[model samples]
Target: MVSLSLGELISSHRSRRNLSLSDLAEMSGVSKSTLSSIESGETKRPSYTTWKKIADAMDIAPSTIINAFVDTTYHPKTLEIVLAEVIREGWEALVAKVAIRYLESPRIDTFRALDHIDGTARDTENKRIKRILCDSIITFTRSRGIPSYLASALYERYLIERDDFSRFEETYRRGKELLLYTEHLYTEDRIDYYYKMGVHANILGLHDESIELCRLGLREDRTDSKQKASAYISLFNSCVYFGDIHVAAIYLKEYENSQYADFRKNHFRATLLAKKGQHEEAIELFRVCLQEAKKEGRISIVVDLMASYLEAGKTDELLRLIESEDQFLPEATPQHPYRMKTLAQYYRRKALCLISLEKFDQGFHSLSESIKYFKQLGTTSEVIDGIRLFLRHHRTNNKNLSFKNMEILEDICDNII
Candidate 1:
């Protein structure tokens, strides 16, 4: 038998019984406004008691009404089924169409659906889908005034994905303009926006801004344990980058004391040790964190652990870590901006190790490959870091460098930076 939406079923049954909404409101003792909302699909999931009252007034079983109303609407199960299908099938045109339709609904499920669709679109480099999803979100938000946080979240992410920081800075200004109005946001959305935007700001090297946003999130009294933990972690990262080591240590300690402490704590501890000039202890902890992160499928942190080894001046260990991680490395596609940055860093570290070992030709080529990946990202800070790496090496190895090699390095730096 065909299924119907809650609204459709209610409207059809009421019509067959020749009951106006006024009559139903009087018979069911539910308010006319509420009854109208139910029939119009504005109130998708009224409480069981409400549904029961309406069902009893119509001389029907609540179970029959509930079962018959299960259809492809804004129910949680419908969202789950659509997400599962999208995951199973890969993002096809049909899936994209259905995803857009589902995302246009003004519900929490619609927010979740948009997140899933946006993730797949980013992975697959589906810019069209991303734009469409953003438009759909804008339309829904304008119409409903709910899920407002998604506009900032998705727009910031889209800008970050393309490494378009010029536009991002403008967006950031607009975001700051909205900060005073954030009291209108749902608590969960407020916390989530702060956490995400804080992390994004940190990644983009806006450490002060990152710290400010994360602190705002932490100040929200209604934040849950997970939300608070996330805020603390973001604060810790920003403090570390902002060179406020004392504050970073405090945040780390707070996270360690929290119930959410896990392998991530080891990673943060390793970072702290590295900052304090305790390279040996940091390296050991990094090794443990790398293993655990790999087991947990945290690819991003695994790359970071590799960088930690490089930063500690353990070139030999860094090389070995790269080789060992070859099998597990995700494909570094130009389409995937974050992966491109990761590979750029990976290759840059490998090039440094090779150069330190006197493998000139291979090292130069590896460095070139690293620069190529960084160029695709349209980012300059990382490219400047690569140039600094060359300069530092050249200073120490001046005698080892052939005059021709020095010219090549200068040319690379001048051309890029």
Candidate 2:
């Protein structure tokens, strides 16, 4: 059944009964103005006695209306479903339509919807709706005049889905600014916000900031076991990135001791093992991690596991792994927010595998493709890292195949730098 606003549902039932607002008011003993206010959504939460009177007048169950409001407030999926229905019904009331759009398209679609709403002149019927819609959209899009807890949640989602680091940084700054002014964040919300901020900082190579954020999350008195585990993991990763393997190992042990150990913990352990030069064990663990991630349809984790393979210098094994998995093609576009970064890594690994097999021309071609993606992402860091990996491998194994290609690689690196 379609979910409707309390007012809309009440109005529909009253219309079906062929009763005017005045007639309903007369029967329910509610004033005509009160009935009109409720019907127009100007009064959302009526007194229970008033609601019961209205329900009695309409000859429907009061519980149904209560449940509808509860579901809309607490269940996001229910709200999304209701929004889909509202959109399908072509509700032209600006506030309802804007709410529908917000639920339907939290990201890009809502931006376009806001633009449309702004361009259209406000009518008398829509003035109130427009004000509410504009406030909500501004809170989300501009990250201003919004509650800190809500702004943090929205920004976290946006940051996680954004591919461009610059854009992600902008959103992060705005979220941080909003959060600074927020005074009433619940413990859970604060923990979640700090965790997301830590992860984002780690991704942007701000290891110290990430470590601090994770520590802050861990220090919260009311953090749950799951949140503590997550904070520990984040701290471990940040330390690892900062080249403090010992400290990372300590946090990793804490994470392992937590009740939340899972495939993620295993994956991090594999990374640590690889960093410690335990290639055989690390490769085995990564293999298991990849299988589990693939089973869960977490393709991003699978791709990341392949990077671990590269780090472990398992080029032949990585190539074999790629060939065995139909989903592990070098040319396919990844669905992750870090699509270009992942793609670059994939091609870089593929090139290293090909180079180790004495296929200079094909390997260089792959390397060039990796460079192209890195260029598109406005970063030469990955390309430089890939080049260094290639140089290290060439010095060890492929020295006889390519002094000429080494010159080309050096030239490419020089130009980019």
Candidate 3:
């Protein structure tokens, strides 16, 4: 199990084939300088694409080159470095192949490494890198003949990356088809797929469908406790979204008894309390959950908590929470899914606060800003929701709204909602 340096391995392979560096470079379609650097150990970590090309030129498996860079126990950071190099070189397909082989290594922390890479790619704020990582994972999972659950997870990730309901619907439909008819997927994969489908359904506002899918997942007698816990949470969230608090409460209790109960339980408890008009208690619980979400770097959950604050009519508290934050409405970038909807919601909440405080002009301005972001998001449902919010709040507090603002709200709702 001698761990030869990558350069030494390359040189040995080239000499065994009696090919000069230039000959290898020509065959591999890589620059001679890059190849030289790799063989001289100057490039300690060559891209997966580069290694694959060289391996192909030398008529050897790409894993041979990958193995040259690691011994029996390699740190996860080493994998991240290689993945970053592969992504930078735009060698998604090659990296997929390499990743599949790497997963077979007994010493590798497969899921942890994959999850770390996924999170890193997400936080990178580079659209190209995110796209490459998505493509690589999809290709790797699908081609490696691994469990279909991995492929389904990657598809879900891509759906989030795309951030379009239409694409999500299409992907979910396709996943359903595969889960129902494909022989390659195991029961466990099917359960995982169903659970994810249920969660995404809730995200897309298909509450009933989400509940059904989650129930279907839970019905699987072979499902492990962890999977069952996930299904229960999905069911609870879906029920909560559909305004069935009693049913949601039942699931919440079950979830609390499950092994995964922790921060998520408190988050759900806060949601239930808020729904029941217990704002003060909900706010306290939300603050705790928000702190934990921040520590976990779960931006979406933080946004959810902010929305909850607004729903609880704790505008002053929400404003105070966001006043000193710099990344509250993180600069929208092409690499990451646009946070237009989240930003729009934030502005709408601000408008509500202003209106409640009798600041009509500032409130109108905030409303207008929210509408602008909603229009940019270009989703019919979101626009309709925005319009509905404006109309509902105006109707409930017409005495406080100026005639001009009322007219504007009427026009917007008449045209959209």
Candidate 4:
């Protein structure tokens, strides 16, 4: 594959759109001369950021531009990393298409490449990749259209985050209808759907729903102990969320009976123990998770452990996490939405920590960036309690939080002003 000549590539798209030099410059924030220089080959090495802005403004992904620029590889060099460009930019569809194309490639990691943390982008392209995976699995079941159950679940979550109860309830009802009556689902197929449904519920703080889906999947799953163990893990996690140690213990026992005691499962088991007054055991489990996370270079897991430390008031472990070299991938790369996303998570956590320490002014800056993250995902209300509680406990002068409770946070929750 020959790289597209800068002139040919830019000219094709620009002329195709009847866009003028100034028009492209305004759209991409590149100066006209630089744009001209690049097109005329006077500028051979444009910066990734500048080139990326041009690609994004043209509504083309880096991979597509790169494909035409350089030889296309059997393995994907870049995957489309979609972030909300404007307040109204609708990426649900763009993302859907990207996954379809990515999955078509046989050499794609298929799992690791799609592993994204929520609220930020990553060079690994994980979150969008996760969404793509879920969407693709369902597409495998539903055949390439939007899955209503997922759409409804996501919309309901979106509404809940915004405190839009009236419509949220309505969407939840609608989503359930689509989910239950979903046609063309094979019994073997529904197991993973149930797992994904549980994940969606978990994201919305709906522990019961997650537990229920996990149970459903477990009940129906026959072929794989791995899936059964996963469902049990979900149930155990839900129990932990509601502080039901009795059930959590039972699930842990069952997990022990089964052969699924990997570090990943053990990590959650540790958090459960740590939070349930078994500090020594919990800390040990956390250390295990920390080691595994470090070994695998899973920053997301590291962040989770760090968050657990923060919640557990384990200052030492939390600080260690803060100093990580991969403090969320801030380097400018063609794989952007994946880049700054980790930085977003890093900052969000830092802000929460700052707020917890009563550093109100600095806390707000970090928190504000954190909020920008949720806002991008159409998420706001879900994190309000955390934000408000942080503000309540730490706000030096505002002192708006009445107690570290949901009621006050819910009342105070509003989009950024």
Prediction 3 global C-alpha lDDT: 0.64
Largest TM-score belongs to which candidate?
Answer: 1
Model 4 poorest 10 in a row by lDDT: 115-124
Greater-lDDT candidate between 1 and 2: 1
**Rank order by lDDT, top first?**
1, 3, 2, 4
lDDT of each: 0.64, 0.61, 0.64, 0.56
> Candidate 1: worst 10 consecutive residues by lDDT?
161-170
After TM-score superposition, the amount by which residue 295's alpha carbon in candidate 3 deviates from its true location, in angstroms, is 5.0
lDDT of 3 by residue, 44-142 (tens): 767656777887888875445555554322445556566566556655554554344444455666565566545655665555556555555555556
Task: Kindly provide the TM-score of model 3 when superposed on the true structure, using C-alpha atoms.
Answer: 0.47
User: What RMSD, rounded to one decimal, does every model reach?
Assistant: 15.0, 14.4, 13.3, 15.7
TM-score of 1: 0.51
Error of 3 at 153 (Å): 14
Which 10 successive residues of model 2 have the least lDDT summed? 119-128
Clashing pairs in 2: none
TM-score on alpha carbons, each prediction: 0.51, 0.48, 0.47, 0.47
lDDT of 4 by residue, 165-196 (tens): 22332333334533543344557556666765
For residue 225, give model 2's deviation from the true position in Å. Answer: 6.4
| Segments in model 3 whose C-alpha atoms lie over 4 Å from true places | 1-166, 173-184, 221-230, 291-315, 322-344, 355-379, 387-417
lDDT of model 4 at residue 290? Answer: 61
